[model samples]
Target: MLVVGAVVLAALMLPGVWHLLRHGLTIVHEAAHAGVAVLVGRRLSGIRVHSDTSGLTVSRGRARGPGMVATVAAGYPGPALLGAAAAWLLSRGYALGVLWLLLLVVVLVLLQIRNWYGLWAVLVSGVALVAVTLWAPAQVQTVVAAGLTWFFLLGAPRAVVEMQVQRRRVRRRGGRDESDAGLLAGLTHVPAIVWVGAFLAVCGVLLAAGGAWLLAAWPVTGITYPPWADVPTCDPMCPSAASATAPGLPFSVCDSEAVSTPPEIEPHSGRNESLSLRRALALLDVCARETDPTGLTAAEIGRRLGVHKSTVLRLAAPLLESELLRRDTTSGRFRLGPGALRLGHAYLSTLDVESVAAPSLDELARTTGCLTVLTVPDGLQSRIAGHRPAPGTAGRAVPRLPSVVPLHCTAPGKAILSVAGTALLERAVAGGLRPVTPRSITDPGELRAEVLRTRRRGFAVDDREFDPDVRAVAAPVLDHTGDVVAALAVVGPAARMSAAAVQEHARSVVLAARTVTRRLGGAGLGPSAAAGGAAEDLRARRGA
Candidate 1:
């Protein structure tokens, strides 16, 4: 159970996974708008679910009025509100209630679904919830509830990202304003980006509230509280409390602790207290990074968090007991515990990219006779999310697969970089292009020109820049809104994957990348598309 939470937690923290799981939130988002339209005395027209995970909720009402604004505003915040409700239910140990509510919502959505596909989607989702609620074991139901809660909490923001992306695309194409963010922009005379921020703020607040409640309701169980917890007025007993005599007081008092005032809260002005709390929360946030559990020592954590080593240990003590952090006995080092994995897994299970792209990537590997990897951007690098090994290549000595690849030296990274804007590209190489090999481009200007070349070519080639005597070719995987969300790469030895083989594999890699991109509800590389333009420019430049 703890491991599930930990996994979900880690997975939720990942932006890459969030895009993959944003579809579930889309259903709720449309449902929320429809529900509000009905509540506000508007006649429902219909709801349409698109292949791209975007949806439309139509209603008949005054062209411009409070009802219209309410309906438009409800769509974006719908998932967050629903998720907040679910979290509240989970925190209150009403997991069964959460399941039933989800079923009810799905049923309601099914009734309003306009098209056959939409009907099928909502019906299937609703029936699944019903089956689980009716036939699944109690523990299974609880897990489902937890998973649903985490999905709502984490997936809501990614949906917002999708909305923002859509908004940008629509602005670029001079298309109709259909997004909730776009609608809110017109309603309040605020920019769409600001509206996106408002939606994010709502989701963030709800997530924090729901997460806190759930944690308190079902926290790690092995930790024993100190005797001070038994003290009658020592609420949330202070970990740093010290004994001090009280002058002319009937009862004995510590420096800050009294029967009347809790020692856990220091006597400070409101602003000071708020600042202190923010700093403490910042420390907690530092320790909660997905990589921190297995990566950082206490001293390293303190340095990163900008606190003293003793202070870090002091603050981490309660978390350790809570099983949020586990200490390795031999090295006395700390890493995230099972709880983090639980959260990570919960978030990952909701995503279907691996299942969706497996066959395509496998085919690419077989066709190219090179290791095919599926990767997504991770800050200034690309992380391998999935891979397919080339045929009859299992027994050979291959390079170790990397969980993360640096942006400047890897084909997958360069492919993604090709589509990035100037500012983002600058940030990516801000740390300076470190040399992985003598051939690696260390100069920022050279790397920038290479990125532009990759953009023109609609793919990237890493010629032993990352690994000595190894070569790779990669293509970007676009999302529905034409955003480069991931990359597909074919990698092999420098000797065997010759210039001719590189050209051959590059075609197969580009085709495979487009296949996965289409499956993800994104645009294909056509004549008018930017990807197609790049390919055209590349061919013209090379006189191919």
Candidate 2:
């Protein structure tokens, strides 16, 4: 029983594995904020769980006070508290109760999720709980419960340690580190490091207490046999061999106490034959990359995995049965199956355009030292949702206005228009092709031609169209289905943004948009769409 928890605790140290696992902790973190906010009489605005495992809980109330402080401080301690509850339930021989509690927790969080990503995360977690509760064998349920308890109890302190590490790194770079500890420091006049130490101490105490409870709840005492493990074989020479081999034998008896002459389980023991989750994912990854119609053979897969071909097929059996991988009967080759597409669709459904585009938008602003913005089509017009200026030009270039501009004149608008369907295009042209500058395309026919050019180039150029002395270049942000969802643009003074400059900047904007597109689970602009633009003439700009 402890082995399961110990394995989960050890897995947390692996970076790749930690990425997916940390989201559960983040959910708990944000739930604590939401719960405390409600208890303090604050109106919970909503919660957003980002793709990167960060979360936000907003509540309407006084910005500062004991209530606000409590809400802010609740996040870091939430998982530990939950783990303690799970430990208590486990100690009482109520393992299934812990699983039910998890389901309840997810349902509550799902009710408050404001963004698609949060909703998807909560829903996925809820589905897993439901599956385990309704379908998993009793043994699997107990192991899962113990593992989850370990994850929460141990993951809390680990998160705090990482938070402190990120804080220090940000401070080293002269950036403001508004971590929970730092926020607490500001509110309570306590040093951030002191708050960090306090969080670590509390979590450590909880971990110690929870661990003891779990240990005491083992099968020898209050617990029973896992009820699913295969019957163990005992030494025939042993006097107590028959009783030791019996079902419902305590773990102590089977593990070491009663079985004095147990057989050894070596690294290659048949009893230890199992495919780990990480290895399964690795197999799927390599198979997914096989573009050939028949896919890679088992021998090739084994070569890539650095294992024997027979071992490959043995390990792949579960994957084939689960429908996550499809094997060709005739050629004995393998490829990703429909089940993988379902997983991909699930991931794509969780993506948010703004959150996905934010990093590239910020990087573009920093790289070009110009005004970079993300725009989406609002009816026939283009709306500027957000903007960032170059490093030294924070308040310059563009006002912090969430303003809409004419689709025919602005770079972002034209970029979006380039790929828009006939209905949207006709509606946009019906808006009179309004001119914002002397050089703007006002005639509907001329505007249609310009959009065609933008389509071929994979980017749009304003060229003093939006403003008399301003030039901008933009590219469309597409989704997994190749539909434009938004546009990315960079604007600068016409003097510094000559035709050559526009060409250079256009490539950067196009590549940035494509990067954001892929990150958002988009298929990206195909070779034909990016041929002359992103491929041949890479856009780049340096703000002056």
Candidate 3:
């Protein structure tokens, strides 16, 4: 059992090891891009991992300028960083870290990015380190060193034992015995001298690069006027704040801080100023909800708002600084930022209506085992409140609720009108009931009769009326004062939803509806209340 458990644990851990090796390369690559972008004074937009095989980092467009050549040159840092981390870990006596470093080297080779030459250099360095460790037999200065070197010292002996076992098995089966001899010969092969030479070569190259980078920095730091220093000096065309580079750059040598000027007093603006701000706010509201703000361009905003591009820029400048909107450097698109997320989350978190209706809709789906829908009366039309798909039936390509559907054709829509009475039905008819589906009741008389029947029966059924092949039965989910706040429905494919199944689940559905209504502090009767004489007949058939 212990052996079995150990084997199972190894099997489980193997995949995780492989996944880490693969994913670590991606992390390092992306981190290098982000770090380089920051170093070159480009504010990062975001890093996106498209898949295991692809990723990209978006930064401020100014990073593409000539002063930022290091940004492009920085790609090699990822593999080199991985190699350095591996060396650090190996020095601290961690075997798994060495394996991870080797795996990262494999990933860099497999990716074959544009900077393959640099990656190749890093990979060869790591491979050389592993080779050196394997070739050199440990000379134990103490008993502890001998104990610590078990895996390395006994590795050859263990391989010999395993090779002998395979040979005996091959002999018993009348197979060739050359495999054991080859393994023994390979194990004893002396390649330590070659490995030591490779390791020394890698160490020398790394030290040379490090020394060059440090010595070259003196030209930029020690000089009173460096070539790059002119780039940081701001003029009227360039804002003084623009000269402020990334953190850790010497602030003392460069007087780059911008001084603020006092605003000139102006005459009081008229009442129209307040009205204009309100109109601007209203236009933003429309843009946020009705349109894809993410797709908006500066010219588009200017066109829609009937303002010049400069005016649009001036108005949006403060918002940009506060992060209310983010501009995508790649596509030059604008979108609501973290500020919008915070505000939207706060509004959604405080919503009581959805909270009251959720449990009832959940229970309806659980009891009926059919897609349950909820809708709120939005003027003459109805907007879906929420939808809960039936158990074992997720990913069935079912449309979400909260989508606008014609008031007269859908079960929840009709259920709302039924409970709201004839006035609401008359308003719906006057509002124009366009035929959405073939089963839609277009005629006023038919719709009126259906509404009356729904009121009498205490529920409504949409028989492929809203959509073909979809049937729904709904009961109005009432609120605290017994006013229908929303409607709940059980919907499924018409073929599977037979008359008998409907009848069988009718009492359970009605009971579930009543349970939710009562929980929400409403006084209402489910379908069972209107069954009258047929209730006993239905119950007896079910042996209840």
Which predicted model would earn the best lDDT? 2
The numbered model that scores best in TM-score is 2
User: Which runs of model 1 end up more than 4 angstroms from their true locations?
Assistant: 1-6, 9-20, 219-544
State the lDDT of candidate 1 residue by residue for 1-544, as single tens digits.
3455577767766866654455567789899999989999999998988756778888998876888888888876787788778877765446678889998888888888898767867777888898988787545677787788777776777678777887788889999877877777787788878888988898888878777766644421111111111111111123333342222111222222211122244456556545444444445445554344355677876665555678667767766676667778878777776765675567546646666678878898888877889898888888899997778877886657979989988999998887755555678767788999976878776676677666644568887789977888898887655778888899888768743577567657766776677666554433245444345435433541
List, residue by residue over 1-544, the lDDT tens digit for candidate 3. Answer: 1222234234334645433333334444555666677777887765544333234555675523542444533433343444444333332323333454454544543343334433444455456445543443221111112121221112222223333566668879997544414322334342423323333444345434433332222111111111112112122111244344312112321222222211232124455555444434433432453346466777776665555666556656666677767779888766676876676567546655567668877877787888877778888877887788898776577665547877799888887877664567778888877887765889876676566555544456776777877777776766645577777778888767754455434434444555556556554632333343133323432441
CA deviation > 4 Å runs, candidate 3: 1-351, 400-402, 525-544
* Candidate 3 Cα lDDT to native: 0.51
Clashes of each: 26, 4, 1
Candidate order (lDDT): 2, 1, 3
TM-score ranking from best to worst? Answer: 2, 1, 3
Choose 1 or 3, whichever is better by TM-score.
1
Q: Give the per-residue lDDT of model 2 (tens digit) for 1-544.
A: 5776779877998998898999999999999999999999999989999999999998999889999999999999899989998998886556778999998989999989999988998899999999997787555677788889999999999999999999989999999968999898989998999989988998898898888888755531122222222223333223364445323322212211221112242334453433344346557766865668889998997766555788668768889988899998899899998888898889877888888898998999887878898998898888887777767854454454448888888889888877765456667766577777777888766666566556654667776777877778898888877788999999888767643455456657866887787687664554344343322222211110
Cα error of candidate 1 at position 262, Å: 66
Error of 1 at 111 (Å): 0.9
